[model samples]
Target chain A: MSDTPMEAAPFAEKAPDAPVRVLSEGLASWLLVSPLAILLAIFLVIPISVIVTVSFWGYNEWDFYPDFTFENYEYLLTSAVTFDTYVKTFSYVLMAWAFTAAIGFAVAYFLAFHVRSTVWQVALFLVCTVPFWTSNIIRMISWIPFLGRNGLANEVLLQAGLIETPLEFLLFSDFAVVLAFVHLYTLFMVVPIFNSMMRIDRSLIEAARDNGASPFQILTNVILPLSKPGLMIGSIFVVTLVMGDFITVRFMSGSQSASVGRIIQNEIALLQYPAAAASAVVLLITVLIMIAVMLRLVDIRKEL
Target chain B: MDRTETKGVSRRALLKGTAAVGAAAVGSGVIGAPMIWAQNIKDVTLRQFGTGVSNLNEVAEKVKEDLGFTLQMTALDSDSVTQRAATQPKSFDIADIEYWICKKVWGAGNLQAMDVSRIENYDKIVGIFKSGKLTPESTIAQGTAPHSVGFVPEPGARAFADEQTNWMTLIPTIYNADTLGIRPDLIGRPINNWSELLNPEFKGKASILDISAIGIMDMAMVCESMGEIQYGDKGNMTQEEIDKTIAIFIEAKRAGQFRAFWKSFDESVNLMASGEVVIQSMWSPAITAVKSKGIPCVYQPLEEGYRSWGGGLGLSANLSGLELDAAYEYINWYLSGWVGGFLMRQGYYSAVPETSKLFMSENEWGYWFEGKEATEVITNPQGSPMAQVGEVRDGGSFEERMGRVACWNAVMDENKYMVRKWNEFIAA
Candidate 1:
C-alpha cells in the first residue's frame, strides 16, 4: 500500500509530461531499427505480399490469371483433408518441440553448469554441432543403413532373439520421421537456450543454497524461472521449423506422410499456382498466430 | 546438369554456327561438297531437354559422331520436363517428353509440327505412333495414344489431329509396356493379377509409385482387378471414379499394405535390392538395374495387362532455316539403327523396329523381341550382363507385352480435381 501511494503520487505529478516523453523515446528507437525494417520490407515483406496478392487470383489447369476470387479459400475451408493435414502437421510440431526442448535443455545445462573450464565447454559445445557439417540429406539417408529392414538395429535385435520378424516401423514410419526431425533441429533449440543459460548470474544459486534451499528446490525455484526466455526462444525456432518442414517428413516417411508445404508443392507441380499461393498464405497466418501466442506467454523483448 | 558434346558450338554461339553453315554452303559449290557439309555441321549445336530415361550422354556423343553436330542433353524429371516444354520455348531446341505431357505443352504452342516426310524411317516407325495399333487386329488402348497427338492437319499447326497426317508433332523415340516388378525369390510364388499387390498375404511387403498422374492409373488397375471400383476409362477417370480409386488405396495404405512408395528409379531399385519390398509398381529399366546386380527381379505381366507410357522428341517453335535443317538431321539420325539398338539393350523399345533389328544380333533379336531363351548372356548398353545364358525375357515377346497394353499414363480433363484427390490420398 505504501509503494502504491508513492507510485501514484509520482505518476499524477508527471501525467502531463508523460505523453511527449514517450513519443520522442519511441521515435528515436524506431529510427535505430529502421535499417532492418527496410531490409525486411524489400526481401521478406515484398515477396510475401506478392504471394498474398496471388492468393486471391483465379487459376485453372493451364495457367493463373489476374482476377479476384474466393474459390481457393472456400475449397480449403470446406475440405476435411485440409483440416486433417493441419492436425497432422501440428502433431509433428508437438513431437519435434518436445524432443528438441528436452534434449537441448539437458545439453545446454551440462555445458553451462557442469563443465569447469571455459575452453573445454566451448570445445564440447562445438562437438555437439559436428553433425551439422554434413548435408542434411546425407545425414537423413545415413539413418537408412542403420534402421532399414535388415539394417544393424534389426540384425542386433534378431540375434538377441528379441523377435522372429524384423521391425517394420524402424524406417519409413512416423517413428523414423520424428527421429530425423529431432536429429536435425536439436541444435536450433540448444544454441539460444545455451546463450541465455550462460548469461544467468551464478550468485543466485549461492544465495538459494545459503538460505537452506535444497538443490532440487533451488533448480525449480531459481534456475527454471530465469531460463524461461531461452526456452521460449528455442521453442519458437523448433515450432516454426517443424511446422513448415515437408522435406524431412517426406524423405523419412518415404512420401507416405503429408505437410502443408507438400500440398503447396504438389499444386505448383500441377501448375495450380493460385491454389498453392492460397495455401501458403493460410500457413503463414497459422504460424504467425502460434508465434504471437508464444510471445504473449513470455514477454521476449523485455527478457532479451 | 547438362552435358554439351560438340565441336564446341555453345548456346550463345548459334550465330557463329549459322555463319559456319553459310560458309560450308559456299564451299559446297566445290569438288568435295559432302566433306564441307560434314565439316561445317560440326560447328552447329542443338539443345535438347527430356526425362533421364532417354537423354543419355551416350546418345549425345553418338549424335556428335554420326550427325556431325553438337547435341546438348539436359535431363529432368517428368513434371519439370512438362513445365519447361510449356513455359520455356527458347530454353531447348528439342523436347523428349511423354505424350500425356504433350497434351499440356501443345496448347502452349511452344512446339511446332515436325514433318513426317523429313524422317527417313518414318514409315518403318511402329504402328502405335502411326495407326494407333501394334498390328492390324490391335485395338488402340485407353489413354492418350501417341498417334492421336503424333500429327497435325497442317504445317505449323498448334492443335493435335485425331488421326495421322504428314505434319507430325513428335518423332517417336522410346516406349514401353510398364507393369509391377517383383522380387520372385522373396515371394516364392507366382503372383499374376494386379489384385495381388494389395493382398493381405503380402501385407507390409508391397509398394506403389508415389507419382500421382501415373500412380493413380496403377491404383485404378488394382481397384478394377480387386472388383472394388469400375471405371469406364482408366486414363480419363471421372471425378467419382477418382474418389473411389483414391479411397481404396488410402484404405490399403492404412492397413499397412505398402512398405514405402517410390518417387525415383533409384528408390525403387533400392527397395527391391534391399529386400524391403517384394512387389511394386516399377519401371522397366529399374527391373533391369535390379537384375544387373544379380538379384532375382522380374517385370511381371499381370492378367489385367499393363499400364504404358511413351516419350518422343518435339521440335521447338523457334527453329527455322539451317538450324532447323540440323535438327531434322538429328531426328533422322536418331531413327537410324545404332541409337535404337543401344536403347533396346536398356529395355526400351525403339520407334522403328525394323531398323533396330538390323543393329541387333540374331540372338539378341530372338531373346528380346521374339521372347526366345537366350543362347548367350545378354548385356546392357554398359556391357554388364543383365541376363544369363538360358533366361527368357520376363513378359515374353514384344507382341505379347505391347499387344496387352491396358492404359497409358494420362493427364485428364479433370486434372486439377484429380491432383487434389491424389494429394488427399497422400495426406490420408
Candidate 2:
C-alpha cells in the first residue's frame, strides 16, 4: 500500500514542464513578429550588407561592375587627400564641438540655477528650440541676408562709419561657417545639458554652500561633476553633426573648405560609388570608435 | 484509463502534426505570392537640377494628368545631377540636364541609348536635334545609329555645326542667347558689341557667371570678334585656345571689372536688382525677372552674338519596364501644342514650332519662328523692348541656333578640369 500510495489520490495533477511552456510562448510571440522581422531583414539588413560588401569591391569604368578588391580601403588608408580630409574634418568638429558645448553649458547653467519659474524656463527653452522647426537650408539661407556684402550688418556698419567698404569677409568664409554651425546646433547641445542640469540634485549645491563653500567652489565641485554626462552627450552630438555636415561648409566656406563630406559628394558625382562607400565606411567606423570610447568613459547607460 | 493512453500518444501522430504545420506554412506563402509580386512593379525616380525652370510640381501634375503615372522629382544642381546619373542609375528615371553636362554623363555610360522610335514626336523635332557625325551618340556609341531624341536645341548657338552636331545630345526646351544685360540708366550709352562690357567706364560694375564653360566660351567669342585668334577652326579650340580665354577673365578679376562672380541664376538677378551691377552676362529668365521688378534692364545684343545652352527631358533606364507606355505618353504630351504654347507664352521657345504659333502673334512668330525681320521692337511685359533696333539679342529660328552652334564646349575632359580649376579659383 505504501509503495503504490499514488492510487490514493483521485484527481492529482502532474507538474507542468516549464521549459516547454516557455518555448511555446516564445514561438507564438515570434510568429506574431515574424513579418516585421522579415521585412527589416529584407529592407535594412540586406541593403546595408550590400553596401558593406560593395565597399570592399573595386570599380570597373567600362562595364561599371564591382570587382572584389581591397584597393578602395587601402587607398583610403594611404591616400594623402583622404588623410588630410580626416585631419581637417577632425579639427572642424573639435572647434565646433568646443564652441557649442561652452555656450550651451553656460545657457543651460543660467536657466537651471538662476531662473526660478518653470513657465519662464520652458518659454526660454522653447525660444531656443523654435529655430529647429525650420528646414536647415532655409535657416542657412537666412544668414546670407544678414551676412552678405550688402547685408544688414554691412549696411549698418557702413552707415555707422565703422567701415568704408562692404565686408567681403563676412559671408563665404570659415568664420561664417562656424557662426552658422553654432547658430544651428547650439540647441542640440543646450537641450541635453539643460535636461542633465534639471536632474541634478538641488540639495548637493545647498550642502556645499551650507558647508561654507563659495559659488565658484560649489559649481566646480558639485555642479560640474554632476553635469559630466550632459556635457559628454552634448559634445558628441555637436561633433558628429559638424563632422557629417557638407552643405553648410560648402555654402559658407566658399568652396575652399572641402570637408570629408564634400569629397565623398565629389567622388560620388564622378560615378565613383565604391570610393564614396569606402569613405563613408571610414567615417562610420571612426564615429563608432568615438561612441565606444565615450560610452566607456561616461557609462551612457546610467545617464540614459 | 483512457487519459493515460491519450498522454502516451504515438510518435507517428506527432510527426503527422509537424508535417501538417509545415504544409500550412508553405500553403500560406503560395497564397500570398501574388501580393508580393504585385508590389514589385518597376519604380523609376528622376533627379533634375535647378529650381525655377523645371518646376517639378507642375511637371509631375502634368505627367499624372496626361500619362496616368507618377514621376518623383528631386531638384539638385548640375554637378549633383551628373553625379547621381553617373553613380546611381537605379535611383533616377529621368534627368533634367543642361546641354553641356551630357559629355560626362554619356561618357560614363550612366545614360541609356534613347530610342527615338518610342517617342511619337520624334519626326517633328527640329533638324538640329538629329544626330550628326560628332554628337554624344557618335562619341558614346562610336558610329552606332543615333537612337536618342534631342528635345532641346540651343538654337543658333552651335559652335561646330560641321564636325559635330552639338544639338544631338540636348533637346531644346527653354533657350535664349546670353545677351548683354545692361542698365541703360547707368550706362547712358548704347552697347552694340562685346567690348562694351570691358569698357573701363563700367569698372567694378560688370559681372559674369563664375562657371568656366559659358564664361570662357563667351570670352572666346569676344576675342574672336576683337581680332584675336583665341579660338581655332571656327570655334573649336584646343586647351591652349581655352587658356587664352581664361586670361581675359583673370585680367578682369585683377582689374576689379566684375562686381561679383555669380554662381547661381538668382544671384545674378539679385546683383542687377540691387544696382550692384550695371551690366553683366545674363540668361533669358534672369532678364525676365529683372524686368518684372520694373527695372530698366535691356538684353543688349553685342556684335559677337549670344552664348547659350539648352535644357530638355530624357527617359530613365528603368522606365523601360513599368512605365514605358506612360513615359512615352508624357513625352509626347509634353511635345504637343498645349505645353509648347505654354512655354512659348512664358518667353521660352519650345521644341514644337506649331505650339509657338498658338500663343505668339504672327509678328512675334515671324521674329522668333521664321527668323524674319521685326517691324517693331520686342517689348517686355512692361512695354519696353529688350533693346533698341540694332542692339537686339540673337533672334532666329530654333534650327539656326542648333545648326550654327560654334564649338560646343569640351565638357568631358577639359570641362571637368575647368570646373575643378574654377573651384580652386573661387578658393583663391
Candidate 3:
C-alpha cells in the first residue's frame, strides 16, 4: 500500500497547482468538445428552435412570415381529420412495436441459449441482418412481385388446390403494412436484446438448474427479469421507428391508411408549414412521454 | 523541481501559442478556399421530369455555348417535380411539368407569366400554341394569380376540343400519343381496339397505366365506342357518363384483369418484359423498349384516337430585372429549331412544326408531325418502321387541333376525394 502511494506521488507532484490545474483541464475539455458542440448548435438546436418559432407564426400564402399567432396550433387541435391521424398513427405504432418485440425476443433467445457453436450463432445473426443491407426502397418493391394479384404466393397456393381465387387481402392492406414493419424492424430489436443476453451470467443459470429448478421456472424467475432492460431498449427502438415511418405505410397501405408522419408530409406538400410544425411538435412531445414512461419501467439508468 | 525548468516554460508557451494560431489560420483557409473560387460564378438551375428523353445535359451545354450562361439540371418524377415547384419556388429557375399539373401549380400562383413579345420565336409557334385562351395577361399576375408563360409542348400537339386532343392551355413541348402496347408472342393475335382489355380470357393478364386523367380518358373513349354513351363530346361529360366509365374500370378490376398498378415508367416496362402483363396502355417509349428487346410488340391503334399528354417549361414567379431578361433569352432559345429537332428525334413531337420538318422526312412528317393519318408507320432506332397501323387522320391541321381546344390545364380541385375514390375502386 505504501509502495502504491509512493508510485503515484511523482505524477501528482508534477501536476499544476490546484486552481491552475482545474482551469487548464476545463479549457482542454472545452477544446476537445467544441466541434461537437458547434455541430449540435447548428444542426439540432437551431433547427428545432426554428421549428418551434415557425409553429407560432402564420403562413402568408406566398411565404412563411414572423407573425406570432397560435392559429396553427389551434387548427391542429380543432381539426378532426388531423387529430384522427394522430390516433391512427399511435395505434399503428403500438401494434407494430408489439409484433416486432414478441418475435424479436424469441429470435434473440434462440440465438443466445439454444445455438451450440459461436460460428453458427454468428452465421444465423448475419442471415437475419442480410435484408437490412439492401436499400429500403428495393426491399419494399420486392414485396410487389410476391404480393401481387398473380404473385408467387397465390400461384403456390393455387397449384396446391388450397384455394380457388387469389387473395386480395395479401397486398395493399393493413396486413401488408404491419408485415413490412415487422420484417424491416425486427432485427433492430433483436440485436440489442441479443447483446444483453450475451452479457447474462451463465453460472447463475447453472446454479438454478443444480437446485432442481424447472426450465420454465429458470426462464421466468432468472432470465426474463434480468432481460427487462434489453426488452425495454428493444421496445424503444421499434416504437420510435414505427411512429415516425411514413414511406412504408404509404407504399404498403396504398391509400387506405393514414399515419401522423404522412399527415405531416401532406401538410408540407400543401405548403402548410406552420400546421406541419405544430403536428411535429405534438409528435415529439408524445414520443418523449413514451420514452420517459419506458425509462421508468426498466430503470435503464442501471443498465447504462 | 528545478528553478531553471520553471523559468524555461514561459518561453515554450509563447511558441505553442503561435503554432496554435497558425494551425487555426490554415484550417480556416482550407475551409474558405472553395467559396473564394466560386464567388465569380452565377448558377442558374432548371429542374424537369421524365428520364432519358428530356436531354438536359445537351440543353445545358447549348445554353452555355450560345448565351454565355451555365445551367444546372436535375431530373425528378412528375409528382416530386410539381411538389418542389409548389414548396421551394426559389430552388429552381425553370420547371417542366405535365399539362394537368401545370394547371394545379399555375393556379397555386407558383409560376411566372411569360412576356410573349420578348420571346422572338413566339410568333413561329405552330397554330396550336397560338390559338389557346392562355394569354400573357391571364397567366402572369403580380401575386397569387395563376398565369405562367414559358410552355414547350410535346407529343399531343393538338388543341383541346370537346371530343379530341384538348390540351391547348399548355405550350406543348413534348407529346407522345397513348396507344395499346401488346406482346405479340403472348396475345398470339393482333390487338386493334380498347375492348380487348376487358375480354374475360385475358383476365389477370391485362394492365393499364395508372395515371388518373389518361386512364379516365381511355375508359370514356371505350364506353363511347361501345355505345355506352354518346361518342362526340368528352369535355362536357355528364356525371352519368363519368360513372359509366368508372363502372367499366371497376368491373375490369373485379375480374382481375389487372395484375398490378405501376407508378413509374420503368415498372410498367418491367411488367411487360416479364410476361406478367400481355397487354397494357402505354406511351411510345414503352413500345420502343419492347422493340429494343427484339420482343415482338406493337403499338396497336384503336378505332378511337389516342389519348395523350404533354409537358411544357414554366417560369418562376420570383424572377425580376436581369434574371427575367435572362429567362426570356433562355425561353426563346428553347423554342428555336435546335430544341424542336432534338425533341422530335426522342419520339416527341414539338410545338415548332417547321423545326420538326427540318429533321423528319416528308412522309414521316406527314404521318407523325402532321397527324395526316390516324395511324402511320414510323421507323424504330434499328431503321425498320415498327408497324404502327391504324385509323390515320391528320392529327387535325394545327389550326383545327388548336382552334377546337376543349380543356386547358384541367386539374381536379378535389384531388383528395378523387384519390380516395380511386383507392376504393382499386380495393374493390
Regions more than 4 Å wrong, model 1: A1-38, B1-40
Ranking by DockQ: 1, 2, 3
Arranged by lDDT, best first:
1, 3, 2
TM-score of chain A of each: 0.88, 0.84, 0.89
The 0-to-1 C-alpha lDDT of every candidate, in the order given, reads 0.86, 0.63, 0.64
How good is the docking of model 1, by CAPRI class?
medium
Decide which is better by lDDT, 1 or 2. 1
Q: Going through the candidates in order, what is chain B's TM-score?
A: 0.91, 0.71, 0.70
Model 1 has how many clashing residue pairs?
Answer: 0
Model 1 residue B312 CA deviation in Å: 0.4
The residue-by-residue lDDT of candidate 3 on B330-413, one tens digit each, is 666666555676566445668666655665666556555555652446664336654356523323333333332222333443
Any runs in candidate 2 off by more than 4 Å, and if so which?
A1-49, A56-63, A69-91, A210-212, A254-256, A288-304, B1-176, B179-282, B296-307, B311-359, B366-406, B414-428
The i-RMS of every model, in angstroms, reads 1.3, 4.9, 5.8
Q: Which digits, one per residue and each the tens of the lDDT, describe model 1 over residues A55-149?
A: 99997656678989999999987887799889989999999899999999889989999998999999999999999999988998889878989
| DockQ each | 0.54, 0.10, 0.07
